[model samples]
Target: MSEKLAKFFKLNERKTDVRTEVMAGITTFMTVSYILVVNPSILSEAGMDRGAVFTATILASVIAILLMGLYANMPFVLAPGMGLNAFFTYSVVLKMGKSWQFALTAVFLEGLIFILLSFFKVREAIFSSIPLSLKKSVSVGIGMFIALVGLTSANLIVQGDGVILALGDIYSKEAIVFFFAFLVMGILSTRNVKGSLLIGIVASTVLALILGVTKLPETGTIFSLPPSLKPIAFKLETHNIFTWEMLMVVFTFLFVDIFDTVGTLTGVAAKADMLDEKGDLPGVSKALMADAIGTTCGALLGTSTVTTFVESASGVAEGGRTGLTSLTSGALFLISLFFFPLFSIVPPAATSAALVIVGVFMMSPILDVDLNDYSEAIPSFITIIMMPFGYSIAEGICFGMISYVILKLAGGKKKDVSPLMIVLAIVFLIKLLAPKIFG
Candidate 1:
């Protein structure tokens, strides 16, 4: 079994052993396990059953993560993405006044489109067309973006009354927990501790209980049967699938998901040193197919798009170098399906600190960007700034790509830009102008 396992995952080639991979997988699972709580809470606001969404979240993640491991043989984990879920709930259901079923139909169609794109190698070509600086910038940009998410989650940052953003009460218990947890992560990770991020998260949760930042679970509330998916599963409202709004919605879903998956896959692979000499992830086709399959399966099972999670970086930092890491995380998610409340009891501040630390891990690629080259620097800067500020990885990539092609073309460096890049820039151009044009 060990020989088959090592041979299947190329553990020896990757310089990772079974025990190291398993521990790294545990570390990865602990870091992203918060999504089991977070995704349901957000989607339930759209009138989906909280219990149902919870079940959907874990089940979808398990399916997707398994595909990533078995098919792609990459350590990337998949889940209903954060920003995309927000879009499903707030932007589509609340703001656009679409029914939740309508949103599901849009997601369903988008996933189908993605499958087609992946099968044809279109997605792979797009992935290869991105400039190296922009690819590195995606990592740095996601670092900042996820750090901002962490700060807000920990109440260390808040929406300002008159300004755009402001600091939270540093004296507050939540802030204190974040500081302590972050320090634990820093020191432990610096000391090369196994599962440093996981340990820090555990430490933060204990402190949260001690300081009353969050409460403990009610007694005897750990394990339970998963809620039925009847309320939300297979509930796509196809009546609007051919409408103008549907077209826009589906297009939006497809566009954002494509780039978001691209950005995430690129960033995490770069962080893991999994990229080849030409700055491309090996087996990217299989990776893209796994993501596409996850999205489609998630929509059918009642959830948002399931794409690669950036939190996978936490495991890579802990020395996870093969599909075994993703497989192990997937197995934990399956077990959690029966232990829902137990995982939910983990305080948001606990996971928030890990995200902030993961952000620091992702920031290393920034040094690779050539600041002296204005064309490269500006787009890279835009990509990095736009992710957190725009609150969308896809939006950041859109702006970065469009600006890169335009700047390169204008500077008589047209040769630097590829034909595919020009095509992508035009698509991004349409995206920027669509709101005004359609409105």
Candidate 2:
């Protein structure tokens, strides 16, 4: 037992130090910190209280991420997912006219299905079925989507009646604050400063306060303990989960979250060298199970779907190689539940700068794709470009699949196309024509 325990922390064997691993851990945590507020912000808009949603966010992040470390042994973080929140708000609650409780119930049901499919290794098959071209496209497409998300979240971009959206005036207080923060972050990252995100955010908050652009709220009103296992013992509108509309919502949620998580985990694992020669990452099944359980747990905790974040790939690039990194991140999230007031004071500009920086970092994988070869290039290029333009992962995927099929057919190599690509192409055409199929 002593020898085994020693081996667990044997830095010499792994050739990685506590300092490096901890830095990697911090990198992973900062990358996904976008969720700490984004989840509650979205759910609050759907009529949930800030405190309750905050509690749910912390619990989901802590429990799900710890499970990823302990079970999957992957340096990945799980949290209330961004895309799924949109589905929960727009598809389930708004379009279906269902209560949030009923929508949460759908999330729970979808999670159960995800668990069972992952149990049967169907998750693995689905991920493997995505062509290399599509994977390359997904990476670049997601990069654009992430950058757009950063811009919109920071109010840098706003809607307009015409094709072009308005870019806010740079002289406005908000714009100036954001520009200053962005400048600081850009300099830090370009200089290869460690903990650049953390530094940039701290600097931004200080500047905002000094410039009188941000003010502290009342002390008593600013801080509170996040709810713990309280939600685990509660219930949502479970009885209505089987209704046709709810079922459709559940299916869509399940499809999107499962695929997204799969793509992110596999892609990150490959980059981190955690994958074997066969391109199989050890404990992938366990990771999927953790994700499914996290989604179920999120619904029970009064939140939307939970999934593994692609942001963890940032940590992978920094040399995070073990579960220790994930464990550190999960513990930090749990601790941050008490520091909500402090983090809440972090301006959107700082956070957006960090996100945009991370987006640029993740885009590095695009250069590895065989773009010089048209066979591998066109479909991937189309998919990558369509992601931000379409503003929907499903739409980007559809475009990729359609292009992959058409390109293969045109090249007189239809057999080279994956069967799933064929099916996706058919569905893409149907969705384009009917649009109600998703309804």
Candidate 3:
């Protein structure tokens, strides 16, 4: 079994062994395991059945991770994307007045477009079309947004009487547990712990139970059959898919999905020494296809957009360089199906810790934004602030793109703005103006 496993994943060629690959996979899974609780919690706010979303999240992750391991020969793992799910629930559903079904349709269409783009390698061109500053800002803005989500869910931040936001009761059990989880996660992470996020989650959950923030599940509920997807699977509403509103939503989904996967791949591939002289990953198309397929399948399975997880870096950092690592992580996601009750029982405070940390992780890209250039810094600043303030990822990107184009054009730096960016700005203008004009 070991020999065949080694030969199949080209372990020797990658200078890795089965044991190392498996360990790396476990490390990756441990680092990202918080998603099992977090994804469903976010999607459930969109009126999705939490259990169904949990099952879909697992299935989508397993399929995509397996594809990454087997087809792309890479160590990356995939899951329903964090910021994408947040946008689906808060932006598309709550703010845009779209139904969850409509949002799912948008995700489905985005996946199809992504597949075509990846197939023709057109995504690479699109990647180069956007400014690096905007890209970094997008990630940073989304990070802030997700962190805000964690804070709000933990009741650490509440709606203010006269202002936009206010502080919650810091002495509450939820607040205490949240801070505890944050401290635990921070300490473990600083010490180079392998599963700091997961450990913090568990520790916080235990504290929550002790404080009576959450009740323990019954014996039968702790380990049971996987939840059925019948409540939500294949529930996309496509009848009004041709509307301009739908177009905007799908386009927004594409924008977020595009950068999430591409940015993650660029960072992870670079770390793995998988990039060539031109700084492009070899066989990137295959990796992209895995993401596209995973997303399409996830939408049908009742989840949000699935994309490559940045936590794959945990595995690579642990000496994982081959597909076998992904395969191991995929297998673990499969095993988690039986423990739905345990994952589902975690309170928002516990998951908030993970999301906040993940948000911190996402903020690293801001270092790539060169603040020396006012032309770049201004738009980057707008992008980073608008996400949480506007309560819309699409709005942030749209405003950022429009601002970037306008600033460059006014500063006699038109050459810095791509034709694609200009076109996108025009569309953004129309989208923003349509509501007032139509009203």
Candidate 4:
């Protein structure tokens, strides 16, 4: 069985064996398993049924990770993205006063457009056209955004009317537990402990239970049948799909997914020493297609945009070099279906710690940015700050793109900006200004 598995995954060529791949896969799943709890909680806030979203989240992840393994032959896992799901719930539905069905329609349309773009190779072209500085900024910006989310969700940070922001009560039991969990996770991660984040999450949950911050579930059973998807599945409202506002939503989803997947793939591939002579990832087009198809399937299953996870780096860091790692993770997700009761009880503070740790992991790329160049530094700064301050990934990207173009043109470095970027900046400007003009 080991020989056949190795042959199928080309493990020998990738310098990985079955045991290593299995361990890598387990590490990957451990780091990302927080999504099992977090995704359902966030989407349920948007009025979707919690059980249904839970089933949908696992199903979407299973299918997407499987496809990524079989087709792309890459060690990556796919799930509903963090920032994109928040945007789906908060920005699109709550802020815009749109129905969850309308938001699902926007996600569906975005996935369809992604499919078309991937088919024509336009997705790759668009990815390649973005300036390297902007790409690094996006990573750093998303890190800050995720960290802010963690702090806010854990009540470690709170709103202040006069001051805009302030620290929450560290003396509170929940806050204390969160801080301890964060400290443990940070130390473990710094020490290169495998599954350290997951361990910290579990430890936090245990502490919360002991401290009376969260209660144990009353249910006696630990396993149960998965919930049906019928409630939210295929519920998209297509009547206003072509409206300019909806189009903008779709563009935002597409833009975030493209860059996020590209960034993750690039980072993980480099970690695995899989990059080609030109520093380009081999078989990346297939990986992008897998991501596109996953988003479409996830929307149909009643979730947000699905994309490759940066947590896959955990697997790569464990010596994963082939798709077997992803396949192993997918298998674990399949088994996770019956354990919903166990996952659903995890407190928000527990997952919040994981988010904070992951956020710190993502900030390493900021050091690569050229901070001395104003043309580069200002846009990067805007991208990094606006994401957390504005509480919207799409808004940060929009402002970052617009600022990059304006600064470059002003600096007489017009040639540094691409035509696609200019068009994107104009689209973003229209999206930003249209509400005032027509309202």
Candidate 5:
């Protein structure tokens, strides 16, 4: 028993601190709890009900992240991801006029492709193909983009006609909740407090309850499970996978999720000191595989695509090592499934509190990029600035990649481009030009 435990936790040779492990678990829990609700909100917009989506979120987080810890031996947590939710709700369902069922089908297919790609040695090849300058840009851009999302979701920013983005009303419900959340997050982050995000969320939830903002519309005569929450006891629809529309949507889902997972892994690696000297990450392929499994499971369970969250870096920074942290985190998520009353009460304001603080933590990687070098500066600048402005993660990433390719090609350094980079560039360009070409 001791030998098996040692191998599972990698604790045989050296001493392990129970306190540090517990702290890491708390960090992972804090980071993922918000997404439990947020995933449903985004997917609900695409016609999914609340309870079923929550169930899927729990199942995916448990299965995928635990697998990551057990097999991959990485301290990253996987869950229903944020950016991909936007893509699924916005691009797939709304923009493409596809049904929610069709969208899930696409997400499932994308996961299969990602799994295949991971096995075929495409993961490292794709990463290597990306331009160095673009990679730097992606790093910085995603950081800034995540921060912008934090701010906007917190209602710190709002849309304005004259301005692309403007300050939100401080007195509004969302804005007020966001303001106090940000305040708490600032204090926790500045003090280098462990579980600072968790603190902010708890504080915000307390304040919201005191202000009489805790009540939400009940599901039925009394709150009960939504039908959609039922695990795949029945399939929704059978779409022709070979159809051009399905194929395009699947490809889009693949493109967005792969890059999103890559960017997240990169960010988390940086936070956890998991990066090699060459700035490349080990275990990324394993992480990608874990993410693919999560997405696949999420689809089968009737939820949106699942991916890695940048916020897991918080747990990593809190002294997490080995897969134990992810396993612990996943266990917490699965256990929470029975506590619907408690889970449903987590106000968006409180969740926003955690997200805003996490955004600030993620922004640390921006400092590593040398702003003085134009090669690095342009792509970084584009990514950092465009994320908030474009209001889409893929747009920001695509722009950064495009700029990096153009700059490198112009510099007569075409030979420096990797085949994967070239493939990404070509695919990205074609994606952008498709409307014009097909129209």
Candidate 6:
């Protein structure tokens, strides 16, 4: 059985064994398992049933990660994206007054478009066309964004009137617990401890429970049947398919998902030493298709855009180089269906520690950015700062792309900007000015 399984995943060729892959998979799952709770909590703000979204999140994750493993033969996991879910709830549904059904429709349409783009190789073209400086900037911007999410979730940071942001009450129990968790995670990581992030999360949760910040789950049973999907699944409202607002929303989803998947794949592949001499991942097209199909399936299952997770880096860092690692994580996601009661007991502060530490891991690529060049530095600065401050990946990328093109053109280096980038800049500008232009 071991030999057959290894042969199926090409384990030996990738210089990995079943035990290593399984351990890597467990590490990956532990780091990303926070999504099991966070995705539903965020999406429920849009009036979706929390239990239903929870079931959908896990189901979508299981299918997507399995496809990524079996078909793409890559060590990556997929789940409903972080920033995209917030955009679905806040920007599209709450701010624009669209129905949650309409938001689901937009996600569906974006996924369909992504599938077509992937099939025709258009997605790869756009990814390859991105400027090197912006690519590095996108990585750093996402790191900042993830860190900001961690800080905000743990209440270590708070809004302020005199200033845009201020520190939270360091003396508060929650804040103290979070800081301690962060310190423990950082030290363990620096000491090269495997599963250090997961250990930190467990330690934080135990502390929270002892401090009375969180309570144990009341569900006496450890296993139960998964919730039915009838409430939210396949509930997309297709009537407003062609409206300008819907188009813009779809574009935003597509733009963010595309870049996020590309960035994560590149980063994790580099960590796993899977990149070729040209700095390209082999079989990336298959991976992108897995992401596209995952998003489409996720919308149908009543969730947000599904993409490759940056948390896959934890697995790669643990010596995961073959699809077996992803397959293991996928299977664990399926098993989690009966254990939601137990997982629900985990405190948000605990998961925030993992996110903050992952943010630290993701910052390494920023060192590669050519900060000496003003043309590169200015746009990169915008990208990194805007992601956390603006609280939107799409907004950060939009500003970064627009600024990069303008800066290059102003510096008499027009050839540095791609035509696709110019068109994207115009689209972003229209998105910004649309209300005034059309109102």
lDDT of candidates 1 onward, in order: 0.89, 0.73, 0.82, 0.82, 0.71, 0.83
Model 4: residues with Cα > 4 Å off, grouped in runs = 1-35, 38-48, 81-103, 235-282, 308-325
lDDT of 3 by residue, 382-401 (tens): 98898789765657777888
**Model 6 poorest 10 in a row by lDDT:** 270-279
- Please report how far candidate 4 places residue 15 from its true position, in Å: 7.7
lDDT preference between candidates 5 and 6, better one: 6
- Prediction 3 TM-score vs. true: 0.75
The best candidate by lDDT is 1
Sort all candidates by lDDT, best to worst. 1, 6, 3, 4, 2, 5
lDDT score, candidate 4, position 129: 62
Q: Which has the better TM-score: candidate 4, or candidate 5?
A: 5
Off by over 4 Å in 2: 1-16, 220-223, 227-233, 270-280, 427-439
Q: Candidate 4, residues 1-439: lDDT per residue as tens digits?
A: 9999888889989888987788778767866787887899999989999889989998989888888899888899999998899999999989998989999999889888888988898867655666777667766776677688788988888997688888888798888778878888888878887667667877988898899887765688778898999999999898988899898889788777776677566545654667665446668888888898889999999999998987776677666788899988998888889976676566778767766776777677677779999999999899878878988666777788899999999999999998998988898788789889999
lDDT of 6 by residue, 78-128 (tens): 999888999999999899998999999999999999999999988777666
- The digit string of per-residue lDDT tens for model 5 on 393-435 reads 6677777777777776787877765666666777889988999
TM-score versus the correct structure, for each prediction:
0.96, 0.88, 0.75, 0.82, 0.86, 0.88
- Alpha-carbon error at 318 in model 4, in Å? 6.8
Pairwise TM-score winner, candidates 3 and 4:
4
Model 1: lDDT to the true structure: 0.89
Which model scores highest in TM-score? 1
Report the C-alpha displacement of residue 38, candidate 1, in angstroms: 2.0
Off by over 4 Å in 5: 1-18, 41-49, 86-98, 131-136, 172-177, 215-236, 317-321, 414-416
Q: For model 5, what is the error of residue 202's alpha carbon versus the real structure, in angstroms, after optimal superposition?
A: 1.9
lDDT of 2 by residue, 83-134 (tens): 8887777766777677778778888888889889989998877676677556
Candidate 3: count of backbone clashes, pairs at least 3 residues apart or interchain:
0
